[model samples]
Target: MSFDEDNSPFGAGVPSDVYQTSIREPVSLEVPEDVNPEAVQPNTSIENESPVNTPPNGPPLADWSSGISIIEAGKSTEGASRGYIAYTIKLGENTVRRRYSEFESLRSILSQIFPLLLIPPIPGKSFNLKLLATPPPNGVDTETKLVEQRKKMLQLFLKECLKMEQVRDTQVFHRFLDPNSNFNEDLRTGEITDLPLNPLCSNPFNGLDTYKNILYSYLPPEVHTTSMDLESLHLQQEDNTKQTSLYEYISLYTHIISSADLSFSHDFDKANKKVSTTARKLTDYYTQCGNSFNSFSLSEPGTELSLLLERIGTSYDQVYLIEEGFIEFIEKRFNDYWKFYLQCFGTIRDVLAFRELKGRQCEYIRSSLASKETAWQAFQKSDDESQRLTQAIRKSEGVASKHRLLLEPSLDVRFVPITVPNPPSKKKGAFSYSLSAFSKLKSTIADVITLQPELSREEQTAQLQTQINVLRQCLILAESDISKMDEFINEQFHLYHDEKLVFMRGLLREYCRHLVEVNEKCAEVWLETKAEIEGLGL
Candidate 1:
């Protein structure tokens, strides 16, 4: 269950050389300088220290355990309608109701005393203005849910404090749990006592092999299994989808950039030159045919043939523009993957920190339990007299009662962690989809070109006539791809429904408009060519 440093999701830090190299050359996709790896990296020097089994044989564990509850359930008497988690804590025999402000005062004092300990996060006041305005359906009000969640979180915090040997045994900690005492007055007058300077207790996390080992020990078997499954799935998805797509995109971009200034092969250049000459010859022949024609039908085919040649010439010449578009895509699209990679890396760092903190807490709990048993046994032996022995037994009974209310042997709290949500993904930034579309387009064009031989005829004029018809069909089929533009956009991007719809419609409209112009010109040429050919009876 232990996770080694190599298993860290953030990977290694970008070398110092990368920054220097990027200044002189093209920038790479390595981790950005802003995400300083050292900031969140676990202190490796402290990872070898063992847990503290005995806490310097401290004074008898203080009777600080208490039964905590929420008092003044409804709205406050003050201006606010939503109520706070006003606590009613019973420390020893005294029970008193106190507000959140008092709990904060206790927390502040505890923090100063236990400087090395991972002081649990306190739940903030949970209130919503909207819930106050209108009641929610099915009696599941937002504000009520918020209050309950906060109460549970706060209860867990106090329980964790009691589980710490250093915290629970201290006079300050006892005053903190005591309901009758004014914690603020105690804080001003009471002195803070540090834990005994034992090697293990002084810096608990100073040497640990794996942060995950402690979490796995405390977590339920099912939760541990589920977490492992999720992690495996995450790694698989990242490798198969995110990283693979990024690699492909980078390769494609590099290929495009390297070949941008490269000329077409000599054969293709020669072929293009011949095609241009042939197109000019066709235009000249059409003009000559027009001059000899006596009827409109004969003249019309010649004019149409001339127009088709011009259209073919125009489409072929736009290859440079297409290449430029590819370059522009690379410049903008890489940013999406760059941002996502950072997010993924950051999540891993957070997981590491959380696991380490939980491990320390678990160690504290183990030490506290041992101390509690020892203190209880020592008291029993020291009070051999009937009067003192009877009082010790009574105090022991109270300790057992408070301990039962807090500790959950069946449910370890260390693994019950919280998480932050992922950031929104950009629509145009889906590089995989973009690359797929490019691949499809290239395949389609190649397939269409192969069909040219099927239209071959013995006579040069007949072959030219068939080639024109086939090219016209290709233009129409390609134009129809624009109709599916919206569907393509929807498939490619992770956008909100309304936003996806809007973007799809807008992009499709613009694309269709461009295609319509191309299609219209092709149609005009085809119609004229057909008319003239029919009139010539060829």
Candidate 2:
């Protein structure tokens, strides 16, 4: 198979003879209790076609429905004899059969169409090990369970597709729903087409700005203002701080575990070396004791002494054997086990950490949006109050009370340095202006409009809005990343389990080997002891 720049599949298209759509009544094939319906099936035809229903104002909707039933029990290409699910998919008025892989292909295409979405995880097509290892008496039921699982997963895949309007309304999706249609073939031939994008949804994958705009487009117009109140900004700042906590937790876990793995590995290796060294030294000591016994003469007392020394040397040899066993079984075996153990630990830790990391990123997105929304509302409310106060002053037509103009509004006011003109009449005490001065005050207040606060509010609002957008993009990116991680896990799950299987096999092999070696060594030791006793004439 070949792939396009977008990683879409393009290869040998389905044969022209197989291009026909299948339409038939829903067919049901009973599956046995022991065999999984998802195990296998021959590519059987149930072809038909129906007209597409075009709506007056929206995209054309195809009357697609789906059903699943067990098909004939047969040997799958994988050589497993199991029942197959005859998934009946209805597009318009036509129905046909499909395999689970078809469902996977459909999901893959939809993922490309909506890159930002978390395409729900799919069950891997490979057989579960339990099913493969089941005894014949119990095999059928395990297969049945697997089949059921696959059915549910396939259903979930379809359900998720229906949830997304972009996917559900697409002609290509309907074609996929059509059991007779070769969706993969269409993809290979580049005949697959997507429905028009929703007006509110910009191509999220295009760039950061587009992604941000897509999020903004979802907000209500009333709370869409670019202004923010100081109070709301403060609240948002608190939430932003809260978002960091998850990050810190993830970082701490990764750092600690990674460091611990290295340190523990070193310590374990050191312990192994010590055990091996002890084993070697003990063996040498036993050898020296045996050599010392050889120097004894064959006189009665000498012979007795030599025999006693030989017995002691034999007991020491047993001890030496035990020491060697410790090195071989405990030290060397554990060393090998620790390598894979650390690998497994790291894999599990990374998965968990990545999950938490995504969760933190999601929280940040939610909080940022919430803060922006709150600030926008507050700014609107504050703006409304200011406008109302200005309107009241204007309505008074220059006769409003000084206290009412300056105090009745109940605004948070701050004093700033302003140059005051000296009174022309040289009035003592406070030089007070008439009500006309209040008019200029009103215009001046209106002109500046809380100049510093306004500017600060605007800048904060802009910053919040931008963060909101970036965070939203991050959220989508998180979904994409986590989904990829899930796929990786699924793809490697069998290998992961196989690691355990391999370990168990190695353990069994080691046990057998040690058992045989111990048996042979005991025979050798017994034979030598018997020979020495005979030669001593004891």
Candidate 3:
């Protein structure tokens, strides 16, 4: 499948085949031999559509206005020999089946395609690793619990993706939900491959843009520093008198979220697991107490006391059932929610890491330019010295030529080789010293000329200047990228914070509501028991 300039599978003005209204239902897991898969279509009639109810103080419901649901999950009949489960997704009247690996691919592609956006996490492959490693015997349905959990989490994943406009509008996303569309084929030849191998080195908004890719390529290779290393560096920078740039500040923020004292994932995991463990213990105690009361009541069979004890035992049973529901709620809502945010922490770190790399790229370019400039200056000094030496040698030659001309005109006046026989031994004088110095100077100039680079000094200077100019351009682009990234990350952080607050508010509200319900039912049970005891006149 080919993507257009806008990254849509269909070119501009071509309406997508995907239905505008999203509603889904699960069909039978077993595909019939005679049934045509292409014939199945989601109902798009307006009358059949139902309004969506959004919770108060929650995220905006626009993205989820068109609901996506996982109707059922079962082993694929076509792949029965290998035995992998497939989840049936329904949106409006449209339905499609996808495997866990497909969901993995989808998320991977989305992250690369939109690195700046927050991509939701899916249940890891480890969740069903056992089932995959050893498929059940034919017709056997083992690991139903794992499959059920995956279905719930995957459904949540789709809904979360729908909440983001950028994610929902993507052609790949729509194709994944299109029953007739070949999603795997599209994935193989998708626009994502056209992007730079490093997602950070591509346009955040449009990775396929060649011009943007070229500019981004100027960025330095990604730094492989660990979180601890980054944290240490950040602290060192903080200690300096110089103010931290936005990128450094973001790095520090992400480090704190992922690894520091303010780590949400770490704290949430600890708290959530503690709650689950405590609930399990409470349920176990209730079970034991209920059994004990029942056993004791049997000794007083047919007595009013026996009935009273039985009633009390029944209350314990009721409370146990309520607690069991509460446990399920915690697992589904709180535990899963924590896992989602944990994945988000990873994504946040990756984004900040990209920014860090870009910042480093800028630094690298500046350093390169500085070194080039220094080399150029040194070359200029040498060139100037060479010029002065050449001018001095020419002046000396001109004086020698003038003397030769005058001597040639007086050739007849002749001469003599008269030598002062007993001339005092010539003392080392200024004239001799000057002659020695001139000889040394001539050699120095010769060495300078001979030791010159293969390229002329002018050419060498031009080359260095060229390199400096390229580095300067790269620095400009790197800085621009960093600035854009900073703004985008900041905006996303705010959005994430808002969503987190809404999610936590809803979570706590539901938790309290469930607790109130359990208490109310328990109170009614005890009140009935009291009324019965009074009726017995005990």
Candidate 4:
């Protein structure tokens, strides 16, 4: 979602403002790591669109019927193996190999690797990768044509095998939405291995409200999902009944982003073809435009501008990665759910195989939006605040030039503190440890601000003063919510990224300092209600 114009931050529009607004270090591209030929376009038409690498900001959420992961695949540079990822998915593990002879083993492997897929299995219709590798009467193998026909199928196979570990993350999101689950049995593995609902249970999509109304209409009615209308998605009111946990929401968004990055919904040779084509294009595009982002407007220099902003905005590999990731997430999520379902209720084989997105509709979307919206809103607000402060500096400077000298620039500002209705108050010495940690952080941040070069004593003082206040406010905020960290987990599926989790962790960590207790009252209610449904309905 775009930031508000009126409340703009960073003086992006405030011409006179000198400070960098959306300030962050320039992140280096993965470079040779993402060597694709299509990325190069010696000549390009003017088209300002969402880069292939950027997330597709689609429509609001709806039901599962309205909820298809906006399939924005076919992007990404063949960015090589991530060290962290490689370590996480060590090969030769039971979770990685796809044993075709044993369907259960195959399914297990698929579930671990691909957790968000919704492909209807073409029963009795199976083909092996090894089969495709063999030569045939046609010189190449018949498997070549087979993969070319259903290219995405092969891509899907690789996606599950090579990435998407949602099945491995099952008990997480499930526990998050199902409040009845307990998280006391902390797993030292730093993941949710034990499911409170069914220590063995699991479940999968993208929020499809993005296509304006055109795409939304294409979805069937059986699916249930909440809209992602920007206004509705924002966690504005603390006590509002519509309020959802932000952590869960971010996890969902992360899934969508990952979906685009790892899309491989194609068949063998075709999937390889797709990969090769993309790789060729990327290599060309980047090779042509070396170290010159501003040289061309948006699209690279030599191709017909794509009409769709989603497609035009990013490089080919970026979008491809996202789509591959999305497909992989589905495959992984589904198997996790199925396995968990089997563990939770042995007799409901029918339900495990047949359940749709009808039941978890509202909560899924709600939680996703809630989680992500927090950071988005905060970032938005913070940006706006930064701009306002910068603008104020400009205005005050003009006035001072006319008048005289001053040692410190005082910025007495007013902010409407966001409230979380009856926010769990910090307990006595609850944040002692965090407080100690924060004190050091405060000094560090202060020093960093003080050290920013080339400022007059007056300006440096002003910046230092501003940083002190910001640091102090952040610490206080940390104290208020640190204790709720662990409790939030075992609850959310971690739809967001590390930033979102850290935010929650920070809050909970602060709270834990004072030995504050997490309120499981809400969780208790959720479990009982779910039990009743499983017992009577099943």
Candidate 5:
């Protein structure tokens, strides 16, 4: 329960007892069509383990239990009912029987064994997720890639089918949370509509053409993709299916990860300990490794990574279904797909980087091959193909042509300036006045949050919290404005008042915008104070 430096679960792990590599096939349990919805609420659902035998709480689970290696494949077992707030070491297909936090912790943990996942699975070891990134052999045709892609689809599809039938997940209620988002059906429809009223954009209509231009330019390319021949996209075609749209896929991933059942029964007040505080309590298991008892992020964006994976998973059809808002829950709950859209961002980045490296390596190889007179004709063809592939990769990965160098062979976290929409609508120039208003409001709420000796326990405490909330929401509106402005901007704007947090301004602006607009009184005050919004640098 202590959250000090040492006790902090900086890294998490499964139970130490979960290290068993072999399993006896136990009875199977059938998944029901209607899972108990109440249990689906956050923190209210019952917790279960992977039918492992615990040795009388011998010790808590370590963040990384070195003694155990998950078996390559697991012996299927069914009919298990035990309650624990932790994970079971999964022996079955790593795809199935997810170790509770698999989608989140798995990436980081498995990455340690990366470049290895691209290699074939070890005979007796579990399937490492590397083959996906493994490069194809030399001289392989696109047809071959198509065939391989189809094969993968079939296997994954079948796996998904079996999972639906056999793996009955313990209905864990992720406590309900209230969303700050507002999905106005009308505003979503209009031409030249307004950004939701938030602090940064207290009045996006506030005459800041610079911010407006950013919004105009930032419109998602998908919106304008109507010209592409949908019929030509043969999902069944080998190469067609093999070729993926990283942007669409990852954005969908982000939304799902960001969503929590808004209906989760949240305990906003810290004192409500009696309302069945029985879920996600596994921090106790990973204590030895300086981990916490639970696996929750317990910070802003209070969501679990598993919940995100549950949305638009790698399963081919399901991914599209979620992205296209085919799932009623996802569509209704998430409204806008921005959250899901972001998930694949990192993946898109990686794929682009990969192609760049391949490009450089092939270039050097071809140059050497030609000079040595080793299959010079074939080398020239390959070098051309490599160059084309690099172009395709760059284009697909969402990086502009001029910044192609960012995808170079060696990947480093470089600080590059990205342009954002100008806040005001219909304008193409920067407006210091508009942005300055945002900073003014941010200062206001910040002053509220700072401890005041005179009113440390002020009766207006709730009112201040509400004020802060409004400011945050406005910031969000401003950000959305920026994103939508993408299609309208020719370049990325580098806005850094602090020199640092340049990338963070979008986030802060969103928060501040949200906080300002949520409260009528606060908005009124902001209107009065920032009405002039001039003579000072924005």
Candidate 6:
């Protein structure tokens, strides 16, 4: 899970060039050199062009320096009598207010539009449904804390989205940040709506126009098997000597991340709870010690001992303040970081699942093509056999007719009388009479109703041929799609691992910094307390 240089999960011995060569050129985000930047409006749709709103001269880019942030959160006063929490988001100069549900909608829309990409996860509405339903006595305080937590997490979500080049350049991402834009309306009449219901069966790059591509239309509706099943099937194909297929690579990566997630969850959860509990207890203990010292000082007023007691009380109060601040820091940094990390894992899993589905779609099309081709071959054989039988029968009939004509011309015919045969007597059985009536009724119904003629061999063969053609075309498209998807996923896989490394480094650095700062501050407080005791000559 740790992607340190020496212990990289991706083969450390493998040359970087191998990965670089395997990857296809990424979808360019630059505007074409031939296109006039000035003429390009904000909403213009151009291939290979960045969708982010930018000045005419500059390439469209996300400004991470003045990154997206949730600046504030408060109870909504607009629209309804029942107020809900709304978060005020700030992206550079632009500011917009959105509710949690709106954020959820934005994520959903982004995911649909870029189904192959890893969209960042947002905070859930409620962590504990029971707790939410039954608010504590200090419900206002709890609500405030929840709002603060969401503000932090939502800001992280936005930042994570911006970090992704594809996600950052989307108009949807920009609109979510725009103050005047109606995101809900945009979603209603957006590219997401135009995309196929099953994105796996469509072209990921140009999903809205997938209908125009007949090949994509012929793709199977959905993958019948789960991603895990696909992974298991490909597990045996993996070997150290050869480069694994993209699907196999994704499967391996997914399993690794899952294992890492489980380990991290167990260890981090235990550590976080331990630290939180310790901080709280220390704070309580300091409060009690401070109270005792203060009481002793009050009892020994007007003496040096009283002043010393008050100094000790003040030191305990300082420690109490430090511990309280530490608790808040732990909650914001450690707890929230773990939650966000888990969400990242979830997002990665989703992206991998999408890749698996695409692989399955390709497999389905290929199998279908094979089956169709086999059927077409069978139809051809049957048609050929029928044609030979038809020709032989016609030839025999012609020969017989010629012989009969020759014989008639050569010989005079003689007439002969034959004895007539009597008909058999009918049995008067009730069963026989009923069977006869049923048979006559069946005959009458058959004469009244006309059955559709079965397709002739030629017709059946032609139909099979048509299907074969379609499946072949579908297989071609599916193979092409899978190839492109693999390239994309391969690139994304490297990018994700690189990002993970950076994120992990940052997390470790932040943790160290927080601990160092807290320890240093606590040491200074104790040193001051020691100095005060020395000044009293105790």
TM of each candidate vs. truth: 0.24, 0.34, 0.67, 0.19, 0.16, 0.76
Models sorted by lDDT, best on top: 6, 3, 2, 1, 4, 5
- Candidate that would win on lDDT: 6
Off by over 4 Å in 4: 1-98, 101-134, 138-242, 246-492, 499-538
Report the alpha-carbon TM-score of model 1 versus the true structure: 0.24
> What C-alpha RMSD separates each model from the true structure?
42.2, 24.5, 16.9, 35.4, 41.0, 11.8
Query: What are the per-residue Cα lDDT tens digits for candidate 3 across 169-207?
Result: 566776677677677777556554465555545665545
| TM-score of model 3 vs. true structure | 0.67
Any runs in candidate 3 off by more than 4 Å, and if so which? Answer: 1-66, 77-81, 132-142, 210-213, 222-278, 281-313, 398-461
Better candidate number, 3 or 4, judged by TM-score: 3
TM for candidate 4 is 0.19
Q: Write down the lDDT of every candidate, Cα atoms only.
A: 0.40, 0.47, 0.63, 0.31, 0.28, 0.65
Q: Is candidate 1 or candidate 3 better by TM-score?
A: 3
lDDT of 2 by residue, 134-163 (tens): 437757767765665555555545654565
Task: Give the per-residue lDDT of model 4 (tens digit) for 167-191.
Answer: 2223322221122333222111213
Total backbone clashes of model 3? Answer: 9
RMSD of model 1 against the true structure: 42.2
How close to the true structure is residue 4 of candidate 6, measured as C-alpha lDDT? Answer: 23
Runs of candidate 6 with Cα error greater than 4 angstroms are 1-61, 77-81, 127-137, 209-212, 227-252, 409-457
Q: Give the TM-score of candidate 2.
A: 0.34
lDDT of 5 at 243: 29
Name the lDDT value of residue 149 in candidate 3. Answer: 74
Score candidate 5 by TM-score against the native. Answer: 0.16
- Candidate 3, lDDT over the whole model: 0.63
lDDT of 1 by residue, 1-538 (tens): 1111111112231221211111122111112223322233222232223333212222232333344444333334343475444555544445555556666655544443333344544655445623533546754466665555555555656765676555555566566555555665554444422221111122233212223222112211111111211122111222366534433433443343234213223442355346446444544554454444324334455576544444333433342234333333322332222222223222222222222332333333334335444654554455356458789999999999999988856878778778879899767667988998999999999888776742432233343333333323322322232222222222322222233235435543644454355446545655665675566553
